[model samples]
Target: MDKFTTLTAVAAPLPMINVDTDMIIPKQFLKTVERTGLAKGLFFELRETPDGKPVPDFFMNQPQYKGAQILVAGDNFGCGSSREHAPWALLDYGIRCVISTSYADIFYNNCFQNGILPITLPKAEVDKLMDAAKRGHNARISVDLEKQEVTGPDGGVIKFEIDAHKKHCLLNGLDNIGLTLEKKSKIDSFESKQHGTQPWLYAQAGR
Candidate 1:
């Protein structure tokens, strides 16, 4: 996972509510575990037509938002199945942050794990960001995790609250495995002590 300290980039406005995992990457694109190729499948149905042509009206399909690094979305974003692929797709598509009025619990948690910042702000604040996003590439948004603040195009700032532990992990680029690795020396010492205390246990495992 990458460190998410601060990000300043174009934000794509996705005003639709109740966006689920299937709508994000679709079931057809779920077979592959690799994250890189999933960007093409992000919002696959909304981005493509029946013939697989890009939809001109879709926010992400539009030229201005094609490289958006942040998303200002409606309420209940990332609802439905608890698929880790959803965040993977979003991250792979260059969305470092998602600002919404609300988000599903599992998806919100998944975002933090995947180095994506899922921000929950009041409706009024989100609406402001959405409006800013509508201005296209000119309206770049700034997300500063250390300060827990999001600054919109017009220089208005919105403060958000986040779990301290999750904040710490993201700042240091520490996932679950990375967190465990932080105690490598301790773990190695404990294993050495256990090996000496229970030589029979190690011998039994050798069989």
Candidate 2:
């Protein structure tokens, strides 16, 4: 996981509701556990035609939105199955943040674990950002986690609320594994004490 303190980058507008996990990476691409190459399969059906050619009209396929690090999406984003791969694909495609009016609970949790910031804002605010994102190369959205604020291209700022724990995790780049590692010394000490207290249990393990 990477620290997500602040970001100022191009935001691609995806104004479709109920964008599910399958629609994100597709079932065919779910066979691999590796995260790197999943970007090729990100929004595969929406991005490609029957013959596997790129869809010219798709937001992601457009040249101006290439390398976009933010996504301003519609409501119910990341719905359906609780697949961690959805966030993996999004992160691999360089989407560090997703701003929507709402999101599925499972997918929202998965985003934080994978270092993707899933933001929930009111419909009016999201609509404004979506419009800013539509301005092509000129509009770059800025997100600051510490301040819990999003600055649109036109210099308008919108404040958002997030759980303090989640904010801390993102600021420190702490995933579940990273959080556990932070207590390694305590874990080691506990294990050492347990070993001394239960010699017979340790001996049975040796068998």
Candidate 3:
């Protein structure tokens, strides 16, 4: 996972509500456990036609949003079954953050775990940003994690709240494994003591 201290990038507007996990990466793309290569499958159905042709109508398919790293979407974003792959796909596609009026609980939690900031703001503020996103490459907005503030291209600012623990983890680029590694010395000491007390087990294995 990467540290998310601050980000300023183009935000793609996805004004559709109830954008589910299936619509994100599709069920067929869930076969692989690897996180890489899933970006191509992100918004698979929306970006492609029934015959596998590019739709050219989806927000992501537009030239202006080609390299967008942030998404401003409508309410009920990321709804449906819990699928971690959806976040993986988004992250792989370079989306480090998503802003919406509302999000599914599971998806919201999943975003934090994957280092993707899913912000839930009031409808009015989201609509403001969504409007700014319509400006194409000029949709640059700065998200400062330390300040818990989002700054638009025009210098407008909005504040958001984050869980203390999750905020700490994201700031330090600490995932579950990274967090456990923080106690490596203590774990190593405990293992050393166990080896000393259970010398027979070690000797048997070594023999």
Candidate 4:
């Protein structure tokens, strides 16, 4: 996971509600566990035609939004199955942040684990951002995690709230494994003590 402090980049507008995980990466692309190439499969159905050609009208397929790092989407974003690959695909496609009125619980948490910031704002605020994102690459959005603010192209700012612990983890780039590693010394000491107390058990396990 990468540290997420402040990001200022182009935001792609996706105004559809109930955008599920399957719609994100699709079932056909779920064969691989590797996160690297999933970007090609991101929004697979919407981005490609029956012949596998890029759909010209799609927001992500458009030239201006091809490299967008932020997404301003409609309500119920990332709904349906709890697939971790959804966030992986988004991150791989360079989407560092997603701003929506609401999100599915599992997908929201998955974003944090994968270093993507999932922001929930009021519908009005999200609508404002979505409209700004419609301006294409010209309207860049700024997301500052430390300040919990999303600034629009015209300099308007909307404040948001996030869990303090999640904020800390993202700021320092700590995932679940990273959090566990923080207590490495304590775990090592406990294991050493246990080994001394149960030498016979360790020998049997080794066999």
Candidate 5:
């Protein structure tokens, strides 16, 4: 996981709601446990045609949003089956944050774990940001995780709420594994002492 402090980048606007996991990465691309390379399959159906050619009409397909790091989308985004790959795909595609009026609980939680910030803002604020995103690469939005505020292209600011704990974890780039590693010294000491006292546990009689 990467530390998310402040991001100033182009935002892609996705106005459709109920964007499920399948639509995000599709079922065909779910076999890999590896988080990398899933970006190729991100928004598969929406980005490609029946012959597998990239569609020109898609927002992500447009040249301006080719490297967008932020996404401004409609409400109820990331609904349906709880595949964590959705966030993985977005992250792989360089999307560090997603802002919508609302999001599915499972997907929202998954974003935090996968180093993606899923922001829920009011519709009025979202509309304002969405319009800014439509201004192509020239319009960049800044998301300050520490300040919990999104600064729009035209100098407008929108405050957002995030779980205090989640903010702490993201600020430190601490995932579940990273959190565990924070206590590595203590764990190592415990195991060393435990093995010395209970040597039988480390021995494999069969081996």
Candidate 6:
């Protein structure tokens, strides 16, 4: 995981509601656990035809939206079965932040775990950003995690709320493993004490 303090980049507009995890990376691409190559499958169905031809009209396929790091999406984004790969694919594709009116609970948490910021704003505010996103690379959306604010291209600022603990974890680049490591000394001490008290627990297998 990477620290997410602030980000300013072109935002790709995805105005469709009810975007599920399958639509994001597709089932065919979920076999592997590696996150790097999943970008090729991000929105695979939307970006390519059944015959494997590119969909030139899709926002992601358009030249202006290439390398977009922010996504302004419609309501109920990432709705469907819980899949950690959804956020992995988005992060692999360079999407550091996602702004939507609503999101599925599992996907929202997955974003934070994967170092992606999933923002939930009112419909009016999201709509405003969506309009700005239509301006292509010219309109850059800025997200400041510390301030919990998102500034649109028109200089409009919208404030959002997030859990304080999650904010701290993201700011410090602490995933579950990283968090556990923070208490290494305590864990080591506890193990040493336990070993002294419960010698049989550490006895050799043959014994």
Score every model by TM-score: 0.96, 0.97, 0.93, 0.96, 0.93, 0.96
Model 3 earns a TM-score of 0.93
Better of 2 and 3 by lDDT: 2
Sort the candidates on lDDT, descending order: 2, 4, 6, 1, 3, 5
Candidate 3, poorest ten consecutive residues by summed lDDT:
198-207
* Model 6, span 44-83: residue lDDT tens: 9999999999998788889999889999999999999898
Candidate 4 error regions (>4 Å)? none
Backbone clashes in model 1: 0
**lDDT, candidate 3, at 202:** 76
TM-score of 6: 0.96
Error of 6 at 125 (Å): 0.3
Runs in model 1 lying further than 4 Å from the true structure? none
Per model, state how many residue pairs clash.
0, 0, 0, 0, 0, 0
User: Judged by lDDT against the true structure, how good is candidate 4?
Assistant: 0.93
Q: How many backbone clashes does candidate 3 have?
A: 0
Query: Tens-digit lDDT track for model 5 on 1-207?
Result: 899999999999887888888999899999999999999899999989999888887887899997899999988999999999999999999999999999889999999898888889999999988888888987699999999999999898889999999999999999889999999999999988978898887788421
Q: What value does the lDDT take at residue 4 in candidate 2?
A: 97
Task: Estimate, for each residue in 123-195, the C-alpha lDDT of model 1 and write its tens digit.
Answer: 9999988988999988799999999999989998899999999999999999899999999999999888989
Model 5 weakest 10-residue run by lDDT: 198-207
Clash pairs, candidate 5, are: none
